[model samples]
Target: MNEQVIVTGASGFVGRCIVKALLVRGVGVRLLVRDPARAAALFPARGVELVEIEDLFTASVETLQTALAGGGMLVHAAWYAEPGQYLDSTRNLVCLTGSLHLAEAFVAAGGRRFVGVGSCAEYDPTPGHLGIHTPLRPQTLYGACKASTYQVLEQLLPGAGVEFAWCRPFYLYGEGEDPRRLVAYLHARLAAGLPVDLGSGEQVRDYLDVERAGEMIAEVALGGRCGAFNICSGRGQSVRQIAERVADGYGRRDLLRFGARPDNPQDPPCIIGVLEET
Candidate 1:
């Protein structure tokens, strides 16, 4: 692993895992975070240098260049939480809706490898998708943002020469995730010996453990190329099935409660996406 690296969203679920993985590989990290106190709390190692200040939304290219100078790779994992920031559709309609400006700044500063985190939602829901070979069917605002960002990167290629690889994680779960997240929420509920609430639980989706995602991202950051791939188990599991598995693992079968949670408006008619071939 290269020592000079910058990781945005160091406080996020996937970002934290990536940071930890980089540290494990003996890489020197420059973690970019918006909140200083949050950075201090998350960075357990004495080796990391936290850059807590303005972000892609606020930082100038010159300021970002100073911070990003000489980094071998830039792992772009930060974004605004949708629905609260702008209407989902509006966010996607614009180019560079996310930290794409940050990507430009990274390129300006001579960074090489650019590994980005995206969503499986980038694909349309109508088709029975399987792997990376399908046409994009982005059905939501966030998905459209990600899809457009990839297009932007592609358009900048040839001259840019920035080695870019994007990973569309189908579903991810781990400790320290937001309480509102389904998996972590279930983890907490199961830990507390309470029934987990999942509406219908009929939706079939893929879930990737954050640890595996971290490793894959690290692999791409080092020397990966410009392409998109789905980083998933390639195995579809129903919501109820996962709950049952988690309960079985935790020996809390008696506390499995079934119910409904508010579904996203753009919730695909079904949950499925083409991912990287395993």
Candidate 2:
């Protein structure tokens, strides 16, 4: 395999971590981003190349081919993930089409491996441990798009002689996480000594540190792993537990206001992934 890896969404939260992990391994990296200046600032180091594109959704086939050329692996992590609007965003259709185009271009350009980041939402939200074999019944546009990509590419790429893997990540929290996300919101509220409004606090979820998740993603890209893998901690923890943990860290558990906010009726009571050791 070629030592160079091409990564889309290299400036996003999870993408940045994956880039860092690959760089630490002394792998040559080519980053595709809409903003070259921002990616440069974020990853200013040796062995990394930045390729600026106006938008992946509208990027030309030639542009994708150029970025993917001679790379051993292509990690497609870019997608529209705006805090409040992404779940049902129409942009997901654009992502699905664009990502599929990129995958096709990568395979034609001799890329040996293709790894795309999926979401736990792609699985049916029944309360149980989700595995790679779990039936995919995505609930939202975002999940549907991811599941669609996995279904198409899992069959398309390998037939074209390109190794394919889809990584489904559970709740992720760490540096660069959006402030509107659960962990960041809780941490911010607790640190300010303010009451943190929460729901019933009984919804169980699988949370994984973003850094570890990135490492696992990088390993999948560099290794010979194929098919779907869950990037998660495997263990389940309630929303209340996570809030309490953050509050405790801030020395303000008393400030936690469970039941202050109403729970989303669509949210599954429990959604955890079955562990897949790297």
Candidate 3:
């Protein structure tokens, strides 16, 4: 009779919002956090509990599975954008293994309805010859790892009696996010009255608010059908457009600048995912 839920990456921007949504709906949330102190002390409501992972990025599947046995739903939001992996092909397997373990163990314990967050980067740059669902030919390490996880989960979970729901979120802008990220950084710089040095600004990205995405994810976890859903504003925004919006919102239009640094080769150019088949 325990209506409990477990979430990975609970201390992160989107993870926190998902936890909050569950809590607001009167569901007990068990957050798998690396460091509880790093989170806001007031994050947990009367029914919320924070379960710290003693060995992050190293815990066994059995360990995490047992942790999830008491949950009604699980959301895998934990990702390693860390530089230690160097985005190498071999390291991608390690990250993918950890991601799968969460789902595997959760299923082993009779819990299904696993929600995994995917990125727009997983889509093919052009559908010309490939069309849609084209094997996810990723360029960067992060994209490769995400792609790897998606395929394996789909193939393996069917045998385990677990259903998977993937949510491909577009560019999300919000507070308490890392400053190095594009939207968060631009918001901070514009708020600080500093010149926003941006690239060509032609790179259009699908943007969604973190809070809104969280609500959608919660709904999917409960009643969403199988397969992936594109969780975005269903619209795209360029870099310059985002800068201008932030400037206008913060009233700092004069601080916008262009042509800052050369774009990274790994950075996707105009990465916008189209979500079809609602």
Candidate 4:
């Protein structure tokens, strides 16, 4: 029997892409989802199996072990990411605790590799490229929780003989994204011929297509490397540039209204990631 890769949050935007990439590579996948019907509807891949769990944050160690049986790699992407509420949500603490418990369960279940999805928020909001070795001074509650999880797992997983990798993804734009996100918002407004309320639009961010980001994450899970890896394009582009590009696709650059909205006071001017060579 081939080793099965177990993926949490398999119904999410990025998780769906990861499952597709795994299937394209001829790897079997076991998806741990809260809703079996939803997962089935979202992903109908032949090599995918769905394991239903009521709540990952509260699932028992025994249950997790059983669900993860026969799986060699665990790609943990589940979290409380409810758009506007996630940044400061107290639910981050629950996710932090639960993720740690899941990691322990994976190790106990004889899992070989654990790949966790992190975020650019885990880094300090300095106006430059962030490397894996960049100082981690996360400001938001969400970032703090993710950084704390990575720190603990960095110390714990190696001693347990499990290979671990934390992938910090920068901005992503592509299909199935939340409508409130920047790319989706721009697309919607432009497509509808509504004026796009924008800020200075000069903030530099590293954006990668969601599918490519998912592929990079899957590579991290399947490869032998460990530690933190930035899943990004390693290049910076301004928000205005992205907006203009999207507008070009719709032939509606006139709909974009720069400085129509105020920028977040705490938002950094630039937050690009430095890509590591594979």
Candidate 5:
């Protein structure tokens, strides 16, 4: 844990958690961020270094290499994840390209280990339960881009003598979650004593808190594990069940109104991850 690890998007939701987990484990961290002041305010802990990049998705490989120097490992958690619009945004393509550039820089900088964050969307959701062996059939631009990065880096990084791992997270909630996300929205509404609308609430998903997900990703980065790993709760819960559970926290289960909002026809009916390890 003493080795220095460079983390991109250190100011982001998942990224910030990952940085915190690493620091808690006594690992030195170097944050690659667009805003150094913001990152510094987020992590007022010792042994944290912030390296600013004007735009990670547009930074030159040489610039990234210089910024990545001295860090033996990297946890890449940055992406254009602007809630509602990110699913089909062209920014996914930019992120894909920039991630490749960052990988190139990592290799050039003599980095030994590279851990990238991915989403469960990289798999075909029709299967309901996803495992490491599941065939990838990403249905959206964001999933495609993530799957593409995994495929390319799976072959590219190892060939370049750099160890690599990909952490694919399922439905993540908890601290730092965007208000537009399901869990956050439910809390905002329920805490305010307002009615929370939802769809049929039948779709099943695997939910994991972002803090646990971050610890798992940090484990992957610090350990010798390679290839893809699922960061999930390993259990399924219906949307209704999750909503009710959140509502129960505020003693406002009656405020939850299922079927109030039309369900997105494109949403998969179920998505549960099969954890490969403890």
Candidate 6:
């Protein structure tokens, strides 16, 4: 707990939560961020070491190693996660390449443990309830790249004497959520007492608060656990169910219009996570 843990993307929504969780546990943290001022305002506390990286996905291995040197643990939560484009973006390739460099740097720095964040999309979507054993059938470029990263690091890190863990989050939502996402959109509409448009609202998913997801990821970093971990709620709720619950908070169920919009044909009917016992 005393050793410094280096966290990339420490200013991101999930990364912010991860850093906060580590800090709450009294762990020293060094943030790899582009904006040190933003990170400073976010943390505003002692024991946070901020190192500015212009672009993590493009940084050289040596540059990364210099920043990572002397760190005992690394939480790699950085990626090209622009809300709408990330799923199909060619930037995923860049991220994949950069992640490899980052892993190499971690190893070069003699880091003891490396924990990386992943996505549920890495699994085959046909399984409504995905377990760690689920076959990887990433349908989108983003998923494919994430699966690729996990597979590569899974083999490479352990062989290099570095403990590795991958935390795959499913349907995380909460503070700092992208406004275009489901929970945020619902809140925006309901708060304004405006009609909220949606699809059939029948797709079931495993949703977890980002804060709790961060806590779980931090636990993996702090403990001796290895392999893939699903950071999810382990319970499936229909989209309609989630919408209604959000509406109830604003006393505006009338504002929800379930069939106002057409559903994405590609969206899976159900995607839930089965927490892996680690």
- Report lDDT per candidate: 0.73, 0.90, 0.73, 0.91, 0.93, 0.93
Clash count per candidate: 8, 0, 0, 0, 0, 0
Q: State residue 91's C-alpha deviation in candidate 4, in Å.
A: 0.8
Candidate 5 lDDT tens digits, 201-261: 9999999999999998999888898999999999999999999999999999999999999
Q: What is the lDDT of residue 184 in candidate 5?
A: 98
Per-residue accuracy of model 2 over 1-278 as CA lDDT, tens digit each: 34888999998889999999999988989998889889888988988888888898778899888877777788999999999999999999999999999998998898888999999999987748899888999999999999999999999999999999889999999999999999999888777878888899999999999999999899888888899999999899999899888888888989888888899998889989997655
Lowest summed lDDT window (length 10), candidate 1: 82-91
lDDT per residue for candidate 4 within 75-162, as digits (tens), equals 9999888889999999999999999999999888888899999999999878478999898999899999999999999988999999
Runs with alpha carbons beyond 4 Å of true place in candidate 5: none
Which residues of candidate 1, in runs, are more than 4 Å off? 82-95, 259-266, 269-278
Over 101-175, each residue of candidate 6 has an lDDT whose tens digit, in order, gives 999989988899999999999999997899999999999999999999999999999999999999999999999
Candidate with the larger lDDT of 3 and 4: 4
| Clash pairs (backbone) in predicted model 5 | none
TM-score of candidate 5 relative to the true fold: 0.98
Tens-digit per-residue lDDT, 1-278, candidate 1: 34667888788778888888888888878888788678878877866888865655567777777878888688887765433443274644443544667778888888877888877777766665546656666766677788778767766743598887887777788766676677777778989888776676777787789888877787667654668767777777888888888888899877766654655555544565554543
Runs in model 4 lying further than 4 Å from the true structure: none
2 versus 5: better TM-score goes to: 5
Evaluated against the true structure, the overall lDDT of model 6 is 0.93
Distance from true position, residue 199, model 6, in Å?
A: 0.2
